[model samples]
Target chain A: MIEVRLFATLRQGREKSIMLDSKDFSTPGDILKHLDIIPGEVSILLVNGFHKTLDEKLEDGDVVALFPPVGGG
Target chain B: MERRYERNIPALSDQECRLLRSKRVAVIGCGGIGGYLIELLARIGVGYIRTVDGDVFEESNFNRQLLSEQPLMGRPKAKAAEARVQRINPRIEVEPVSAYLDKNTAAEIVSGCDLVLDGLDNIAARRILAAACSEAGVPYIHGAISGWVAQVGISMPGDGLIDILYPQGVSFRDRSVLSFAPSLCASVQAALAVKMLIGRPVETGTIYYFDLLNQEFETIRLDLGKKE
Candidate 1:
């Protein structure tokens, strides 16, 4: 199973988190695709608390968090 | 200090408050965060403040830039910030430099200052300031805001936190910051700078992510490896 967490405004319109079967997705990109989240909407991704590209593979039980761009001021 | 800082006790010892009277702090950017930081530092008795900004106020800045007022629009940001300091405390010295801070001039702008506070609006400019601070061995306080989200971090030489967080050439586009966000983050920046001035040790390379919309906060550790 892979755990996906969302933060900030992203969490506002979606569930705080979701768990998926590893067989359903092989990478963070795939998980976003499966969740119907547009790739362009995310600005950063942390796989188990470190920066990682969306194409990086996700192992069973990996934790993936996504955040949208939030630059201002 | 003076009898003015009597009420600052408990939060600050008399010695600490007095020490603040002898320190100088450089504020890069006289917009929302810089304006508030300059005011806060002045009120807290920081002896000297160097405010840097070349841009004048525009009507659109009224929504979030604290120093921007109807009458002050079209005036230079550093000038308005200096006026704010004067109105708040006649005793504090404010050196307002009405110019854009870039790689070529960052060092000279911040020279002789104990610390540099970044109230800049964009990432590329921040990178330039950070490099300058690192070269000079002065601590740099950073704050950024977007909507209800804000991040504050300290960059000491090797952290390289800014570069890790904002890649080169990437910047905020059409992003909007609610009025309160920059204000809150500015307060945080001022507090941290004060803490550093008072001889308190500060941790660098970690960001405090604040979500005011949901009233939540998180810490993100940034270890982009040591700087070259």
Candidate 2:
């Protein structure tokens, strides 16, 4: 299963988490495409505590989190 | 002779002032709070400043950003801040880089600095900076402002301070709403940075919060051992 999470404004507009079967997806880009999340809308992506770029592949049961850039100071 | 920092000069001797003049500081973000911090540090004669920001001045920045204005809109914030600081005090050295603070560049940028200052808008960047500081063994002053409240803290190496203070993660909000917040927090941060640079004693690994609405301030000791 692929578990996707959202934080901050992204969470406001979408469900915090989404679950998908591992055999149904190949990479994070594919999962994002399936979710219909527009590319570049979210700035940072973390896969299991490590920052990931757009092209990085996903693994089974991986926890992926997305965050939109929000100003704090 | 050129003008000196009258207040800080008297409090800290000439030798200490020279010491401050020889140190390097890197301020990440270059927004409302970062702008104020850059101005203060340059005015007081910090020898080297490395300013980082991947953002440009926008129409919304005019409300509180010291370096933001109608003419400067659409320009790189780091470059504009560097120009403004140079004009304020040409004696100090300023290097402004227009780029995001990521893992690749964080270590190189923060490695030589005596200290790092948080002026970033997002928690992710703060976490990245915190991690870089931890790796580099450099001291970092953290500040965040939201609406009418502001918070400041100093993190030392091996302290695990950021993880303790913001365990769940910091909330990411719109920049415009945090205008007054950064100024208030940056003012205190600038003072603390100067104190740290001059070898003065200051509260470390502790969080300080201020509420502008009620005009009250409070300090809290964090127990980073417990994480959520």
Candidate 3:
């Protein structure tokens, strides 16, 4: 299974973490599509500590986090 | 000599003052933090400054924005900040761009700066700026304030420390619950920018939070070794 995490403002909308079965897909885009997140709404994506483009593939046990843009100051 | 920067000349030697006069800095926002930062940098003899902000002064800003006033109500923040900086130090050059900093323009503005200070209020712009700095191999000083609490950090390329600390899309909603917090954060950010300009080694990649209500300060070192 792959782990998907949401942070910051995005956490306000949904569960913080979600587990996806490994057999469902092979990349981060698959999970994003499965979850039905709008493309532009998710500004930054991190997989395994590195910024990843939407096309990047996901592996089992991968931790993917999504965040929207937030301004506080 | 015009006797410009006489006040700062004593605190920083003539040679160091020259360094300040020769450096160029890019400040991304001209609100609370950016307004104070631009004023400090200009007064201290920072050679050149590029200010960006697509916002204007609203009635809400009069409380904490030093540059905001009734006379300047509804004026573009960039222009107001530019005017104030010029009033403080006419010898320095100030370029005020009234626009938002996005991916396409971030590189162009940030590429030439010796240091980048985070004066923005939102995370999206912050992340874009951070990515641009990393790609350009420049050092970035970041600060955020929300409701009596403020956070500051310095990030270098390849460190991925901010990624761990903020962890992409994680929004601390409580950050905007109060107004005074950004003022405190801006003050700290201004000090950090000054420290960076004078060739000092800043304690980078650590988050420092200040709680004004409780008068508490806490430092959290992000686990740089952590991976997704």
Model 1: per-residue Cα lDDT over A1-73, one tens digit each: 9999887877766788988999989998898888787765565577888777768888998999876655566
Expressed as tens digits, the lDDT of each residue in B91-171 for candidate 3 is: 678888888889888888787888888888877788888889888888887877666656777888767755654544455
Candidate 1 chain B has its poorest 10 consecutive residues by lDDT at B165-174
What order do candidates take by TM-score, descending?
1, 2, 3
Q: Best to worst by lDDT, what's the order?
A: 1, 2, 3
- The reply for model 1, stretches above 4 Å from the true place, is A11-14, A24-44, A50-57, B226-228
The candidate with the higher lDDT, 1 or 2, is 1
Better model by TM-score, 2 or 3? Answer: 2
Strongest candidate by lDDT? 1
Interface RMSD of 3: 6.9
Candidate 1 collision pairs: A73-B121
Candidate 1, residue B222: CA error in Å?
Answer: 2.1
For A30-73, candidate 3 gives per-residue lDDT tens digits of 87788777654564566765566677777888888775433466
C-alpha positional error of residue B64 in candidate 3 after TM-score superposition, expressed in Å: 2.0
Q: Give, for candidate 3 chain B, the lowest lDDT window spanning 10 residues.
A: B168-177
Interface RMSD of 1: 3.5
In Å, residue B26's CA in model 2 sits off its true spot by 0.2
lDDT of 1 by residue, B135-179 (tens): 888889988888888888888875677766675544454377888
